[model samples]
Target: MVCAAMLILDVLSPLLLLSILLPSYGCRAADIPEDATSEFSVRLYHQLQAAGEQDNIIFSPLSVAMALGMVELGARGASLEEIRQVVGFSHLLPGVEFSLLQNLTAALSDDDSHYVIRFANSLFLQEGVTFNPEFLHLVRKYFQADVETVDFSESAAVAEQINNWVENHTESKIRELLSAEDFTSATRLTLVNAVYFRGSWKNQFRPENTRTFSFSRDDGSEVQTLMMYQQGDFYYGEFSDGSQEAGGVYQVLEMPYEGEDMSMMIVLPRQEVPLASLEPIIKAPLLEEWANNVKRQKVEVYLPRFKVEQKIDLKSILQDLGIKHVFTSNADLSAMTDGKDLYIEKAVQKSYLEVTEEGAEGAVGSGMIALTRTLVLYPQVMADHPFFFVIRNRRTGSILFMGRVMTPEVIEPNDHDFDSM
Candidate 1:
């Protein structure tokens, strides 16, 4: 069965706000190397691709990494090794990895009044379970995770409490994250992470300019959908593993958000090449090459206004990625508690993203001045087919969200009828 990507942490601040644009004091920008975050992003994206296949995928790699990192803190021996390998934490020093995560989380959550981006982490323990004081302190200090005692016996109430927390953090875009069926009497610990982001395009698409355009699916079939169009100077580049005519060629375009510090990079495979063909070659080095070589050019661009809401169960995916000891009888969470076997019963993540013409309030401070003259026909980069995208922090090179749009459809606002974890 195919599954949607689920991303997950945080304390219960009445308003758990962190800055994304401007760096918080003492949060050094160089702590987390750009290559490290990029490598993690690409690795997670490829894993999601293998699992989700031709389905639409949307999840925050950063959210998943932070959530798993919380679990990593308490892991020992084989559990620790597997977790590190799967989550890309093996390369950095243990202390440095935790510090980098703490710093990166603070930096990404810090945002101005223009964009709304927030990340939250929380831990729910079965009532009467005694957790290790050191584990609690570490999670609280690094991830700002709020710990709550919930009675697993009262499954309904526990589900409601957890769902309420998720709804509040995601602006209600994700509700009912946990249901009664997901909990059991043996469930001793539950860790959750939710992120909500709403940003307007730096170059807003005219509402009137949005027209029905054909989008090709993976099966070579086509469907008509609303496509937003605009012409402007954007960062663009082409990728070809060999000769362009030999078929491994694609286009990459960077569209910045209102703040200019965050942007989405769209990868459009050439018409003759299937998107699947390019998936295997997606890595940090390729992304770095694109970033270093892309040039500013005037072009006609078309992108679909899309929204993807996905709830995913991460157990299988984690196991497939070599994190096996954490789920089975060999689990070692002694750091968290000496309570009964505390293997993760359920690991779920719910994420929501909406792209529209309006960015932040003061998005357009200066009006555009166009001079009338003989216009030169600009190259067109139309994304009317299957493509992959990565929304990232320009300053940190941390991938906030990544996904593939296979079949673009006009999903009505507030439609929560998609698949559930």
Candidate 2:
């Protein structure tokens, strides 16, 4: 099973507005199709890696794609083509991509008592702008986005309203996602997506077994972190780099959440190889191979309890991925509205993820018993160094969250100031 990440996308433009929030899921390798969402995940990961090297990087490609997909509905000429190419939608017939997205969203958002998941989208239009009825109908039908009119002249009030909506949808995990400066009299539309998920481990980590461990960083230094330990049967695999080059072998392990529908895949390189060496080889095919080949085995696992929060401006990254027209003077979005030069002014995303022994708080009970009868020592999979991880949905084959942990640290909830914005 694969675990998908939560993705949020917001598009700010002078005339056209688009926003998307989507939850992540993972499909079995055998079930995955050569579709736009699947292809876009791989391509966008590489682009993000190249743009932000060595620092902690995490954002949802699906979120960006959904936001762009909404934009595509109104994009014409070069703008549409560039978005389609960059998002890998060119391979599909017109409208097929959006239909697939709608189905995927519905499938992922299906209720589960074992998990808490939320995905929502909305459009905040300038009070006086005239948006095409066709565009509104498509967004409401396919994306289920709520459309509301607000006065951009009252920038602070608008920002608060948008942030309040985001905070409510995300269970307050993400607050102040937008600022007063983000809106102005010239701003015609703002589109937003918000997604939040919390799930428990199928085999919950015992709090008593948690202890401080040495975590090695990329720069050769080490830090002490609280690591949770568990021993269970998990899907595991080992991969070898076929090249005569210095890249060595790596281990992959999949830990399922309580329902066994979603999982976290961890890729750990051998001590001799740095995570940087492994990044170049990560692609959809290789990921699929790992998922298909992993076998169930009793293993010892040690993982750090950590949290990550990130905010990113996607304009330059999209530009690097050959999505240039939408942000420039040549943009043509006549399908959204008439007589307005509707180039995207900003594209931003904010994400937050926390992994703890209790899993997501309200979703699961805490009691779990460990098997102590094994006579032989199980193989160990220690995340003592930097490693890559993907949260995927097994049923849908979508990745909800993906990131590399170089220096794992616990972030107290109160440490972040949401009111400042």
Candidate 3:
């Protein structure tokens, strides 16, 4: 989120590749606000600055390389709002490269569902997908599945290859998350990937003295998440209030990666909280609070090393999320397509995260094939039942696809992509 914001803001949409870092980065005088602006963009810019404000140095060319790629990937037919979401969400990554990788699907094709496979595959072959990646063409051909239940046995081979390549490219930081068996007979796969958070605390936590922590659920059921605790100088704070006036409680902890103090591990909730709702609480002021308020203490921190994998059925979810006008075949996409027939066919997201004392190691990958989500948007409380979630980038206010999980344990990874943004 640091100076990397500069590259995503200007370079991505322009399809520019950044190979070097600028001496100074981030928004200049022209980016700030004087009054009420777009809520999404306002919050976004604020958060971006909040993150970067702590470190006012130069940035490396590599920091923006991935963002530039994602910009190239998503620019066509992607609305201003969508582009904003991409940039805003990309800021969530701690590593420059991981943030860039999160937007891979930004390169997806804008054609109808029929073309997502070829379109996505072609992106892999693009100039900078990776110095070393899996056989891109083969994998795309394999997953361009159909709605009548695809025989993925052949595609499974491609999945294996892609997964292997991803694992290797990520230095084994990501694993077994994507599979050939996950492919559905459904049309093409649309997803987003967020990976690799290797950050230590601003102050190191002694591993030898780590202790087990009691984690209580809303229902009072409990499990133990190992907590990494250290008493000394560190960045810390509290949210003081739940998001959306929901009466929630949270603690913000910032841990730095040993080698890179400039890079850090940002833990949003001191306790387990529903991510869907927590999305609203992540604000620039809250982050500012953490940076300013943390005090040294003899604390007992307990956090679990856990993975959250979600696959969402985006077609219906988008319709329900309040953008119902465009999904219709007769809908007007002139804003995106240049006088051609086009409509969202399906949008799916896949996000994998691993949290531990060592920092967060995860990936959020998403893809789309002429599809979108449909939601009812009733005034019902989101807590009682499972619901879709998205971190619409503030700059663009794009919903960043949509997610739904009636049951996490029973969710089908191939059939859906609850993949959070």
What does the lDDT come to for candidate 1? 0.64
Better of 1 and 3 by TM-score: 1
Who wins the TM-score comparison? 2
Q: Rank the candidates by lDDT, best first.
A: 2, 1, 3
Score each candidate by Cα lDDT.
0.64, 0.68, 0.30
In model 2, the number of clashes is 27
What lDDT is reached at residue 124 by model 3? 20
Regions of model 1 farther than 4 Å from truth: 1-37, 111-114, 243-246, 359-376, 410-421
TM-score per prediction, in order, is: 0.83, 0.86, 0.43
Ranking by TM-score: 2, 1, 3
lDDT of 1 by residue, 1-421 (tens): 0011222111110111111111010111233455355676676677778877677777667766777778788877788788776666778776677888787766655653345655577778767767799999998999888888888768799879877876676555455656776666666667766555556677877766565555788788776655667889888988788853425778999887766767788899976677888777778877767776878898788776665656555666666667787666567767777642555534555544444445322211111322122454976777878888877776667777777888775533233321111
RMSD (Å) per prediction: 7.6, 6.0, 17.0
Off by more than 4 A, model 2: 1-35, 244-246, 361-376, 410-421
Error of 1 at 248 (Å): 3.4
- Cα displacement (angstroms), candidate 1, residue 411, comes to 8.7
Give a tens-digit lDDT track for model 2, residues 1-421. Answer: 1111222112333332222222233222223343356566777677667766666666666666677878888788888888887787787787787887777666656663456665688888877778899989998888899998988879899879987887677666555656676666777767776666666788888776665656788888776666778889999988887872326678999988877877888999876677888888888777778888999999898887666556565666677778888777677877888754777755655555566676543221221333232554977788878888878776555777777787786323243311111
